[model samples]
Target: MKRIILVAGATGNLGNKICKELIKRDADVKAIVRATTSLEKKETLTKMGVEVIEINLSNIDEVEAACLGVDCVISALAGLGDVVLDLQKSVLDGALKAGVPRFIPSDFCTNYNALVPGENRNFDLRRQFKTYLDGTAIKASSIFNGAFADILKYNTPILNLKDKSIGYWGEKADWKLDFTTMEDTAAFTADVALDQNAPRDLQIASFQISPNMIWTDVNTATGQEFRMQQLSNLEDFAQFIKKQRADHPAGENELYAKWQQAQYMYSMFSTQHARLDNLRYKDLDWTTSLEYIKSFVK
Candidate 1:
C-alpha cells in the first residue's frame, strides 16, 4: 500500500521541503495548508501534482475530516497565536478521530527539558501539548534541532551580520547546542516518517554546535571580527523593551507583547545551553556540516 502522509503547514519553508522529500521517496502526500498562505506556494505544490487542502488548525472537526484514511501526520505549525497549543490539540484530536497511527509534532527545535521553567513561552505551551499527546492512543514524537538555521530570515543578530555583530546567549565556552539545517531536517523527517521501524523521539540532525565555536566559524567564514554581546542580566531585556515601546508607539504594541513573552521564556539561555546528541539517525544518511550551513547565509 502506498502510504498516505499528511503534512500540516506544508506551505512553510520546512514543511514544503518535507513534502518534496517524501514525494521523492514515492510517498503520497496531502499538504494541509492555510487558506491565507501565499498563492505562489500553493501553485508550486499544485503543479507538482500533490494534493493541497485548506485547513484551519483551530477547527478540530475540519482537521479530522482532512485526516481521513491518512496513515501519518507531520506538523510544522508555527505562529505567535494561542493556536500554538490549540493546533497540537486539534491535530491529536483529529488524528485519533481519523484513526491515524502516528504523529510527528511541531517540535523541530532543541530539547524541551533544556529550557528552564518559565523560560521560552513556546516551550511551556509545547509541554502542555506533549502532556496531552501522552494521554492519547496515537504514537507521537518531537524532533529537536537546537535552532533552525533559517532563523536569519528574521534578521536575528545571533546568526547574521545585519548589525555588524553576532550575539549568542548561554553559559561557559564548551556549551554546544544541536543544529540541523532546514533542508536536512526536512529530509530526515521524510525518511523517518516512512521507515517502518523508525521510533518516536527520533533525534535527526547534522551535529551539535556551541555558540563559542559558531563564533569562530563566523569569523573564519565572514573574515570580519565579530563582537559577542551576551545578555547576562534578565532585567536588561525588560529595559530594552520599555525603551523600544517608548520610541515606536504606533506598531510597537504587538511586537512589544511578543518580546516580553519571549523575554520571559528565553532568559534561561543566558545561563545554560541544552545539548542534544542526534547521532542515532546517522544510519538514515541525513547529516549536514558547518561548512554546508555557510552556503545558506546569503
Candidate 2:
C-alpha cells in the first residue's frame, strides 16, 4: 500500500521539492497550507496531484484533522521565531493524535545538536523542538544536510562570484564545510520518510570542501582569479555575535538577529563538529562542488 504523507510548509523551497519527490515515488501526498497562500502556489501543487488543504497551523484541531490517515509528516518550515515552534508543535500534536507513525521536523541545516544553546538562535529553536519531541510518543527523524550548496550562488559573505572573492571567518582555510543541494536533500528526505526502517536521525552532505577548494572551483568555473578574504578571526566572530545580540536584543530587530545567527552558524561550520551520514544513502548521486559551481558561475 502507498503511504499517505502530509507535508507542512509545502510552498517553501525545500518543502516544495520534497513534495515533488514524493509525487515521483507515487506516494499519497497531501499539503497543509494557509488560506492566504497564493493561488499560483496552490495550483502548482494541485497540478502535481497533491491534495491541498487550507488551514491555519496555529489551530491544533485543524492541524490534527489534516494529519488524519497520514503515514508520515514532513515539516519544512523556514522561519525564525516562536511562531515556528508553535506551528510545528501543532503539527506534532496532530500527527500523534492521528496516529501517524513518523515525523520529520524542519531541521534541514547543519548538526544543530552538536552546538550549545545560544550559539545560534535558529539552531537553538530546533534544539528546543527536538527536546520536546523526546517526550512524545511520535517517532521523529531529523535530517542535517550541512549548508545548502546553492547558497554559494547568492551574494553571501562566504561566496561572492560577482566580486570574484570567497570569504572565511577564521584564519584557517583548511577547515572543511559540508554542503548539499536542496534538491538532493529533498529527494533523500522523501526516501527516508517512506522507509520504515530508517533511523531517527540522519546526516547527509553533497560535498565537503575547504574555503581554498571552493575558491579554486569558482576560479576554474568562471575563469577568474577570486581573491580570498579573511572576514574575521574566531575571537572577533564571537565578539561580533555578542555585539549583534546586545544591539538587537530579543524581539527587537529581526534583521540583526538573523545576521548574528548567520555569523554564529558560519563559525560552527568552520569547526566541522557534525558527523555526516552520507554513506548510509548509497543510491544517491551527490553533486560535487565543482559541478555545482560550474552550473551557475558561468
Best by lDDT: 2
Tens-digit lDDT string for candidate 2 (1-298):
9999999999988899999999999999999999999999999999999999999888888888999999999999877665457878888888888888999999888887766677777777788888898889988888988888877778676777677787887676777887899998998999988988888889888888888998888878867888898987877877777776677666343624655546545644545635776766677788898989889888
Q: What is the alpha-carbon lDDT for the whole of candidate 2?
A: 0.82
Q: Which ten residues in a row have the lowest lDDT in candidate 2?
A: 251-260
Against the true structure, what is each candidate's TM-score? Answer: 0.79, 0.93
Model 2 TM-score relative to the real fold: 0.93
lDDT score, candidate 1, position 28: 92
Worst 10 residues of 1 by lDDT: 264-273
Error of 2 at 197 (Å): 1.5
Clashes of each: 3, 0
TM-score of 1: 0.79
Candidate lDDT values, in order: 0.68, 0.82
* Model 1, CA-based lDDT: 0.68
